[model samples]
Target chain A: GQQVQQSPASLVLQEGENAELQCNFSSTATRLQWFYQRPGGSLVSLLSNPSGTKHTGRLTSTTVTKERRGSLHISSSQITDSGTYLCAMSNNNAPRFGAGTKLSVKP
Target chain B: ETAVFQTPNYHVTQVGNEVSFNCKQTLGHDTMYWYKQDSKKLLKIMFSYNNKQLIVNETVPRRFSPQSSDKAHLNLRIKSVEPEDSAVYLCASSPDWGSQNTLYFGAGTRLSVL
Candidate 1:
């Protein structure tokens, strides 16, 4: 079974600040995805990066498959950016998610 | 815009009650999955159907079952719900069963068992 671990269980930032979240897996990952979930809301896929780096809006996802690790960076965070950021990895079966990083942006 | 749609955004029932959740994906994906998110926000995979065929069935309780009539629809049924069953059930779909595919998730159904 693959295990995904996310760092900084909780993070707080002021508006316009940058945030970085880390994810590490215990096994080789064939796919990696970053998701955002607002309070009591559905999970929204942010980025899918199996290897190398990917960017969407103010978000950036970088994955090093060989290292079994990935990262999500949020730039110029806003109050609406407050939510839980989840990282999931999969090898050959269903994806496994980490505990998720709770982000709180203060206005 | 969400391509995956789930019915009954929320459900409330007592223990031993039977409950069902419906999920449909307009993305025309060949694989669908059900995941449970607990109060602590820990997400766990429960079942996955590929082309309407059961592919990944985690070590969940036997009372939990997944039904799929086609590649675009996947449903979950709980014969005897327990207090522990109170959680958010998310339905997701991917292009295929391949690990490299990205998953699109529905809004999810929040279950409350009393």
Candidate 2:
């Protein structure tokens, strides 16, 4: 069983559209973080939300620990934002990662 | 803006050969980790160290080992590589070893085993 699960394995959208990504954990998560990875590039941290909603620029993340789920909302998407979005959770001292949502934004 | 650094952006070797990858963090973090991403792009944690002490070791093969000389450096070594070992090895670091901390990752080292 996967400890972390992400919805919409892949998404394609036009520029300026809004995109929503979901993450669900099978167990209790003490921390949650969202990351973005361009093709053949390193993972970049987007947001770290433990339990509440946090915002940064065009990205907004909301995590509800009690439900073991988190979401990343991207507003006004751009072609540069086209990449894989991964959500990771921490349970105890171990880290669990989701399969990730591959998003493509067309200009 | 790159805090985590990894050596040998790419490596291709034959099976049964030894391979090593290096990782360093300049963020003054106390916790570092090594993750493996397979061809399917599935990422999984292999080892984690906090202040040069092993904290987590996943069910990896015996040939795989992680070495950390200090809090800033953590290295991965495979005694005898296999075809299944071909994957992107990523290195990460966090300021502390807690559930609430965020991890910074390095440009992964792509390994290809023949």
Top model by DockQ, which number? 1
Tens digits of per-residue lDDT for model 2 on B23-45?
Answer: 99999999999999997778999
Interface RMSD of 1: 0.8
Candidate 2, what DockQ? 0.81
Candidate 1, residue A70: how far the Cα is off, in Å: 0.8
- Give each model a TM-score: 0.98, 0.98
Identify the CAPRI category of the predicted complex in candidate 1: high
| Chain B TM-score, one value per candidate, order as shown | 0.98, 0.99
Contacts from the true interface found in each model, as a fraction, amount to 0.91, 0.77
Candidate 1 chain B: worst-modelled 10 consecutive residues by lDDT? B95-104
User: Per-prediction count of colliding residue pairs?
Assistant: 0, 0
Top model by lDDT, which number? 1
lDDT of prediction 2: 0.94
Q: In candidate 2, what are the lDDT values of residues A29-107, reduced to their tens digit?
A: 8888999999899999999978999999999999999999999999999999999999999976757899999999998
